[model samples]
Target: MAADEPTGTATLRDVARVAGVSPSTASRVLNGGGRAVSDDLSVRVLAVADALGYVSNQAARALRGQRSGVVLLGGDPRTASIAAMGAGMEEAGRERDVAVSITAVGPDAETHLAALRILRGLRPLALVVTSASFVGTDRELILAELEAAHREGANVVFIGEHDYDFPAVRFDDVEIGHLVARHMASLGRSRPAILTSAGHPAMEGRTQGFLEALAAAGYERDAIAVESVEISREGGRTATRRLLERAEKPDMLLAGNDVLAIGAIHEAHEAGLNVPRDIAVSGVDDIPIARDITPPLTTVSLPFMEAGRAALAMALDGDDQADIHLQSRLIIRDSTVPA
Candidate 1:
């Protein structure tokens, strides 16, 4: 090699050294790229970079070559649905050679706008919304903004039951309610109670479907008792206390999910009610912990692993002609039967 070539190149480390800060911190400020570059550092870093003639490495700037594919999953942080779906979606992505990322939409969070802002910098191939409903938090006018992102080139997939422009693979919550209700009724359990948080769309759908089935069976609303509470185990305990306060408590209890069902089971024991003899119990979503309880919980089950695979398939095809409502099942166990 000829020794005549000039050695007049500057690196990011040179800029950091001049700025008297770490190289990573300098990069963060400079790469903020028109976003909110937290004030003082932005000015200081760029100033020092310019003074030292630190040019960004174009060779290293080739990002597309380094990535195969990326998928983003968004959901409400508080819900178990997010954890369940997030696990399945990520596994699906890994099977297909795609890197998966997750973001939780904090309470009253503007997910759509935040996602859009995030996308301008990183180009993920698709986005999966992990929950059924997002309360309309119109912070900084986010809903319209996310809608624009969907219109533009983003592939959007909703994880639960929804009717939207985006393609979704959802479980049928309505059918789930019917399955559990019919199971209880067939067991000759005349008085059935439902417990849930009405704010969640999935829970609401379950309640509606359960009530509809009862109406078909000649039972009035009063006969089909219901209690509304936060969709938590503690909330279940409290709701159970309310039911116990009544002179005539239900013989069958249908909890919205395994968590509440587990709590209701505890309450039933506390009240000296022998399960299935005094009161029977059922739940939905056959969670991992369902079988671990004293008498394993009977539940309306969903094939979530299959749903995960299908969601990615739909996302890749980018054609949603078929709104696939995957079937749910009633898993019979000791809780709803004579032990």
Candidate 2:
């Protein structure tokens, strides 16, 4: 609200507001995408804008001796969380006057290689390789690709590392598991079941820490049971059914993510469970919908937005920069403890 401060960030709206026209009208005339405005009329508007020093702020900008080359954001399109991350980071890229080119890598080797080659041909400013979730094989492949990109002097930032590492912006799922476990234990949850997908670093790490924490807290090693399934609502529903059918049902369920947690909640209702009284539930990733659930999920908070912001930061880091890992925390809601 300061007098000297600009009213708003430079955007199409500002351009239109200044030119005294609708944003769509300004867009049509400026981009020449739709209707072509009269040459003289367009010239007069542009002249007035030039006099007013009005400049359109777009993500595409030219760098010194080069156009801001496309930065490759490579990931699996099926990976929902990674898609969110890419969307968030793209905004950061725009703020920094860089263009982001996202490419979805397929499962097949031929398809992945072709996509990789095409991305390389773009002469990208850098390549940020990430996984929606990490499995051992995928992590190794991802790390290898990042190493290859690094060797080629392509700015490389890898997310969710398994073995090899490079410049990274990641959160610790292991720590998240530990936090959730300790919280549940403190609330008298001795034997907890973890619902998560197997084959990925996120699930694997969290499961490992959950079990380890249980043992460390003086519980039997076999006391913790993990139901490995796909990281989706349907997957959680299936896994929860199997878990509930066990000889002795678990006292608590720790879902790997909020979506799975939501599924588990619904499953509990189907199984004639009384939630915290019959079996408490918790999850990782305090997604937007987490708070809207019946018991309001007790879950760990992943810094997803922070991860995206960190990606752009890594992209802009100085040469010889190393990786950075952020920690996750637990958000204890009604689902895990007695009031």
Candidate 3:
């Protein structure tokens, strides 16, 4: 090799030499193959491999009929929550020596079908679905793809929805709603209203839980008003404005997520109503911004990052069938406190 050319690409032999281990031992540890190797030896080999910028030869592995260490993630990347989950998955993948590839798909039928087809073609070690729901009315096509992946020895994991038989990592959305509602009720906010995304299964489940808990807390059905909106700040603002126009205004507004809750706060300010005094507001999904906003927003904290990591672990390490349910806690903040 020319002196100007980078020293020949680092190899497994170089990693083994630097770590003082045999090439076979290094291979077993680094490749995650089933070979009895000491934890200390594995750690040393991995450390040396990282320091040397060593990468396994994919072509050679292919020739040896080894499966690629790739995890495929499908979701709408534009959403902040989904984006965060994807980042968490990537971090977990690096730690496990696996590759994660994300594909953004719209909420349309054609896009979802195309994404599923592409996922089937990749035949990755695992497939993670982070979208709210699959494309089209029927889930047959997506379910078929999942079944195909499973038959080929690939794992399938869903983030939110539990429509399929595959393993899933999901938050207890119903419980989240119940917690937030109970909090509102404890504050003596008997008149409550909910603003939520239209046609979202998880959000719908949360709404159902909230209404049930509110009713159990002596809030009559006639006293509650639930509005389905576009799942945005503007939608929340618009819906809250309508609610404010009513003669008997609600004392508490429950938003499906933080974005909507923030919008509700904005509308309250514009209407010359003081939050927590005129109307207390709360939302779900304790996003980063939830804590930064004025009079920090009270909400349900879903372990989204933990869910991402758990999904990866379930896909790569757990049994063929696993169900991981994460908890959501009520985060009490200034927004929900009565003046």
Candidate 4:
């Protein structure tokens, strides 16, 4: 080794020595000890550690009874809501000086469990799970993994709907359906169809609410039709085609999400139906593209970012056992109501 070069991996003591701080103070700044450190001292210690290439041993820190300064978020990043939630969590993490790691949880039982194991191995201070739906033995096994992680000193927080005994931030999925149903009724839409993917509890809850509201409005229970398809634009298109093929076609289409709504609109146009004139369409999750389409889509705008912030706050010890319900509202656009 060069005379002036480091001979071995930099330790906490080495960092303290180079930064002119005490070993205990260095530990407080780097080891997530939960003790307050002066900003100047923290900055200097971090700079020295970075200069020395000091990589934190998270497992060692955990063994020593210190939590890692990381928050692990498990969700599918492909969806717009999850993406927005991640951005919100990142913003909150920056404010709290904590790091955020987003891991994609698979849609299936086996892959989901594997992802949970990986997250547990990371030993984050907090684990936030979202955009997942499991049932029967799969649900039980996944819950066990989460409980194990929680017992090992990680804060477990869930976003979206789950009956598990964990801190959760949930959206008003039923109310989301009610909003669409109420809007449709206001527009004098009598015959309606729902486009959604099966096996999703959140979507199912919304559909239930929609059905209840439609029933209360004096619509026959059998009058409404629900089509289950893949949760994609093509899926929406296929479902819409099937509904449009019926002898007494639906006058309005209610999609479980904006993506499906987009497909429904496309299919309606392809069949030479004028949106909001010949047929009306509405969806949940007001994604960016909702407004940019030829005739902007009417959708329920969800507070994904707020939900993200709330989830992170809970993970950071805000309130662990409480169920936080975020509100979503309806946005009227050309898709459902013509200009």
For model 4, how does the per-residue alpha-carbon lDDT over 183-240 read when each residue is reduced to its tens digit?
8877786688888777677788889888888888888988899999877899999999
Mark the regions of model 1 whose C-alpha exceeds 4 Å error after superposition. Answer: 1-62, 65-81, 110-116, 133-143
Any idea what lDDT model 2 has? 0.68
Return the top candidate by TM-score.
3
Q: lDDT of all predictions, in order shown?
A: 0.69, 0.68, 0.77, 0.79
lDDT order, best first, reads 4, 3, 1, 2
Instruction: Mark the regions of model 4 whose C-alpha exceeds 4 Å error after superposition.
Output: 1-65, 69-75, 131-137, 318-320
Stretches > 4 Å off in candidate 3:
1-17, 20-66, 69-74, 131-138
For each of the candidates, the C-alpha root-mean-square deviation to the true structure, in angstroms, is 11.5, 7.5, 7.1, 7.2
lDDT measured at residue 323 in model 1 versus the true structure, 0 to 100:
66
lDDT of prediction 4? 0.79
Say which prediction, candidate 2 or candidate 4, comes out ahead on TM-score. 4
TM-score of every prediction relative to native: 0.73, 0.75, 0.81, 0.80
lDDT, model 4, position 77: 81
Best by lDDT: 4
Over 1-339, each residue of candidate 2 has an lDDT whose tens digit, in order, gives 221112244455556677777665555554433235667667655665455554443322222223233353544654445666676666566545455666766655455656767765555667776755233334455456656656665676666644554577767778777888777777676567888776666777878777777777787877677788877788888888998898878878878788888899899988998777888888887877888888899988777666766777687664467677877777888887642
